[model samples]
Target chain A: MSDLEEYKTVIGLSFGNQNSSISFTKDGKTECLANEEGDRQIPAIFSYQGSEEYHGVQAYGQLVRNSHNTILNFRDMLGKSSEDVTDKKHKRSAKPISVNGQPGFSVTVVDPETGAETTSKKTVYEFTVRHLNRLFESARDFLGKKLDGCVIAVPSDFSEKQIEMLSKASKEAGVPAMQFVKESAAQILALMYSDSALVDKFVVVADFGATRSEVSVASIKSGIITILSNEQDLHLGGEQLTEVLVNFFAKEFEKKHKINPLTNRRAIAKLHAQCEITKRILSNNTTASAAIDSLVDGIDFHSNINRLRFELAGSSIFNKMSDLVVKAVKKAGLETVDINEVILAGGASHSPKLTSLMWSVFPEQTVIRSSASSATPLAVNPAELAAVGAGVQASLIAEFDADEIAGSLTPDVVNAPHLTKPIGINEGDNFVVVFDIETALPAQKSIECVAPAEGGAYIPIYEGERSIKVTTVEADADESDFSEEEEPEEIRERVVTPGTLLATVNIADVAPKAKVEVILHLDAEGKLTVTARPKDGKGSNVRGSN
Target chain B: MSAGKSIPLFPSKTAIEASFVPHAKVSKPVVRSVEPIGPYFLAHARRLKYGRTFSEDER
Candidate 1:
């Protein structure tokens, strides 16, 4: 291989549903990059006030008044149709519209001079592109140079289509050379690099963010981390806790001023912001009081909530989180005793109540021959851990490029593939497993099957744990982009099917009972390659066909 | 203080016992892996991306 040149500037980005963070590697140390305001984590929000676009923290502030124009929670809507929206908050916050006949959001824009209002339809993909553009722009401003590449960390549950869309958006956003990684896997990389002694351990990662909670069981053996099982709750998140407080404060304000804060979007947004602060304050203190002046219709609102009251109000959300942890451990085919340590990620994990809940659920000791009693949450900065880990990955990727770029820094982390679903071949209506769930990637498996004389062998390969209702739609070529008004791409929903079809392989003109070897290899980037060959046939070997 | 400090999300002392009862059955794990770049997902992204190409700016 020829010597590859190093980049002038690159960054690692943790893209979350609610907030995102950026980090970079300098002199072998991963440092979280702050925005212009010197805040490490920036709100994943955008606001448009008559063509004046604001992003990050500024957009979050504008959301208080321009609730209709500000866009948040676009991350959760990726690869999902309007019908797929189950959360009431998302449904209420984002006005669903048709984009080219597909599900999209409507942004209400007002004319600056005429005071006329108009609406524009945009898909989640377009929204993501806008966000990515702003993120790259921020990084460029911070570094005083354009970014050459980036490694963005994403949720483990993002679908293949979603990942592809993100990659496409990165290219459109001017960051063409980019890589995507699972957030938990990135966190594990950061952990491994920080603690060299970490090996042969079964770690459960509980990543509780603003709008979702993810629990994953990962085992590290021989310098590689394999995700045993992953479970997530879309409904259970810090937003639920914030909603509890939002409602609580709203009701209190209503009782005093005879005005329902929830009735007004601006008031709700302001209360939501205050609730977030109260949630953080209640984390450390026994009681936290929230006071917002001119919160709703020029009325000041004050509400005091003790930890006990706050916990009771948000108990359902916590219950859902605990439920997810149990399911994750069960799916991993392990008991609580098997867990070495629970690694926490995201800002919500810092809540004392939530951390205590984690300890109670996964105690160090339970049954006979218990290895550990109470497996405490790993001590790490939960907010920036994933971003920092992504920086480490970018460094590792850089090292693989050239020895000059490595410059005396060698990350002791081995990138592992944590399969969300089993990759298998469909044979006679029965799924035959090739790569089992949680098997570390850069792994391969071979299967031998007899070829039929008449029809040969038709093998359908799929990647998914359970049967999913998939609707494949092609972009309508007849539709023109220059149309005055766009409809959510005229998508005709077809027959619902099960499983994602990775590829199909056909073995033709083979004698009956002829041995055919089928090998499937999952690469480091989670891409699969299939090779098929017949034992007695020459020039019939299919190499890396998929 | 620690014993009672924990919220009674589940009524029992052993929180896992009651909390383990899943309120909503998860048909699929929402946490999806990022699209593994066919090149990098194979453990060769950097080798394939930078190993061969020298950008004009870098040179």
Candidate 2:
């Protein structure tokens, strides 16, 4: 073990509620590792049949036959009490029950020797430990070395209690959890570090996963990334989209056999599994088919659906996702025009329909990095982005002391106070921002402005708030008279509200067209100092601090 | 002084201050760049050592 220490092997783990992935960094490049079954996106599932146990894709396969014994989608139940899990509709898997007031699932265990079946209860925490152990073992087997440690990418909405439970589970599994990076931050880090030209841009990371969708706006300035606003819809995700296809196919089967597959639990489970595959296929092709043998009443089911129909079927959910992105941008106190880039992450983000819809939501100039975009830095596989980012983070901190890493993750250090609104100067009726919001402490900016053409200028330094102004443009009366009536167009313009006047500087007797240099420095203690001087040395210099 | 006239002055030695409260500051993590590793580096090293280029697949 001591001899192997020189290698410093570490892995990044992106553990989601529906699926999880593991990644490793080699030669400063990160890659997701496939499990023994050649699956990079491993299902977060476990199953028991008699004396045998199944995991990953095998466990997913058991959902159809052993729906009562297969446990899946339990990652989100961690750290929740039994009463907190109000959703008792276990259509595809084991029913969650209370085990000592904690969330647990009831499964039947069969004894091989006696052929006896007995019921057993397993808490979510125990399953999490086993899941982590399996992931670490698979990673170790692939790397052929003992792991130094690992960084886990978690959702930004995870509470302190959930994070603590996850940390404890990792400890129980004997996998060192070096750090917990926010999934959005991890995705941005992977992109920023891979491409050096992504600095000083406002990025929106739309992570559409299987069970939930998370959208966050982040500002990356000088290599430091800060999340400006975050929005999450727990009920919206890939499963919802799959359900649309499942319903469509179920209707098609009903039309043929006069039987509804949704009436049977087993049939629904089978349709769900098949529809998930069909959905993934539709992401790559314009049309896809779903087939299931012995789907219902000893009948085989086969159907085909085109991408246009599938997208139309799922249009409501897609629109909701776009609305979520708009809400995130609005919450960040920004307009769509202010966003520089949108980085798509998570498995569900691979849908071409969703990618194209993003163009309508953001400005035409915004660069969206996805499989459908022709951007220079093409989107990394949305499924493996967070894991790759975690891997990169793991490699960076693998050699650091554990205590040092812990100290850096404390709330005080992570949530250090930053500027909530931008500080800028008022030029006539326009406000030109000099220092952006969320800038780290002790920052400075210098700008050279020309004095007014006719007289000296009064520069008022103020804190600015961003807002959107909407105006409606009526349709042309001649065009409407000849053609069908058209809906009025609403144009949204970004408006800045400069309310808080911080300071004002007056310069007298400045020559026309002369340059006046203004320097603003903000110290670590939040002290602001402004210095202005005329380049021609003809006007009076003014200096002030706040 | 007349109402239309203004006085021109030189740059002041003392700086003017404003009333603004600063939030408490905290230390941030120091992110260090890790040295590159893996097949590409190994191939480069082999080429330098043996005076021949080695394909990444050879590893």
Candidate 3:
């Protein structure tokens, strides 16, 4: 491979209700491709096809026409326990949540022959990972070469655990190394790219998508974005907008054709789809038509939906997400004006009224759409920016992984994946001694703690402030950083006490194994007297008092 | 009290716990590692982190 070819390539990924994308960088240009459009966002859509199965856009369309075999909005509902959302059954005809194939999420699926049941069972992570791996493989194919590595973009709100699942899924997708990017951070990046001042700037991004509404304000500096406040409603988004419009049209049907819209499952689905489309239209246009097909009462309604009314039905929800945007700004202790920019992104951000509301709320700031064009991209595409950022992160991380193998001066520290508590500490978990409610922790001050051993045992220098988190500390004598103040006048006959640490074994073997012997060094002040033998070979650690 | 009444300035417990060992007449105050200065973790995070990520050449 050429030098440029040797530069590790990483594929950036982003996924949504019905689509997933991949982007790759080569020769200073990046390429994007949407792998799953006609395909089901999650192929687990037909996992339990008792007799036959329906899938892809066909299954999506079948949702409205054939109620017996269709599920929608099942993606976002994953990972949530049933107790968290019992009403999910009403929203999705078949809840697709599953637990070990227990139908955690259900979707009604009509048997191609029987047309009896339209539901299957599986955990959200399991099902979603399966589909995600499939989608990722398709994205991998876009390169037309063997896979290199994958960078997966996860929702900003994904829990640490979710990221773990993402890691596993990425591995299953045949990508060993994966990096994470917050969706909001990615949007903020695209928002920043549209303008460079994004570094050291504060901006609120209201990501209103088909199934989720997330509001986050981030501060960018030195190409790093600090997510300040993140609040989102996984259960809320464009779906609610569609629901309100569905109800409005249902009422109109009752008045114009004397037919209730909800009596027929097929009609409800078709109407929901129609309302969703019209809602998007009304986001910009003053009005749009909502078309519904009815059978039993021989009724059909094509009603004009005004932008004003659309906002009336779902403005609260939008404003709810907006309220959080305000909080995002507030969390940074900045007013709307303090926000240099506001990013209108996500599939739902296209709402001009929503954009207008965001603008009016922060009249001074530019209410720019993070992603603006259809083909050429008027702005950065917020939807896929996380993927791009993840790719960038992946590339950087790939370099780190390679460099790691090459060896660096980084202090050898213990870190285990899924080890919540690293022997003594946890992953990414650090406690600082700060004076304020939530401010930067000051430089760690050395403090003394005792284990209260039976006999007089010598004290070993402990590194972590939190008892659960211990770090390896270099001996002060070995470090050049410490300089001696004039030696304290030694007290005559002070005498070494029996409790003195005769020897310290610093390095130890893993649990369930023998511990490595520790070498000891002592100082007059009774500082930690510890050292370690080189594990590889015999370079006997020197032991004596300094 | 005699003119040369001997008095211990510090309790042996403090000295011993300070990592001092007993010596004959006029025991020298030998210092060990830095007590207060450290990259200290309470229980020891490094032992765990290093134990897994990097295998000892012995392995």
**lDDT digits (tens) for residues A347-381 of candidate 3:** 66666666666655764434445443232233445
TM-score of model 3 relative to the true fold?
0.60
RMSD in angstroms between candidate 3 and the native structure over all alpha carbons:
19.1
Q: After superposition, how far is residue A494 of candidate 3 from its true place, in Å?
A: 63
What are the per-residue Cα lDDT tens digits for candidate 2 across A241-334? 9999999999999999999999999999999999999999998899998899999999999889999999999999999888999999999877
lDDT of 3 at A479: 47
Residue A348, model 2, lDDT: 92
Candidate 1's residue-wise lDDT over A280-354, tens digit each?
888778899998888877888887999899889888887788788788988987667556667777788766766
Q: What CA root-mean-square deviation does each model show from the true structure? A: 19.8, 10.5, 19.1
- TM-score of the second chain in candidate 2: 0.29
Instruction: Considering the two chains of model 1, state its CAPRI-style docking category.
Output: incorrect
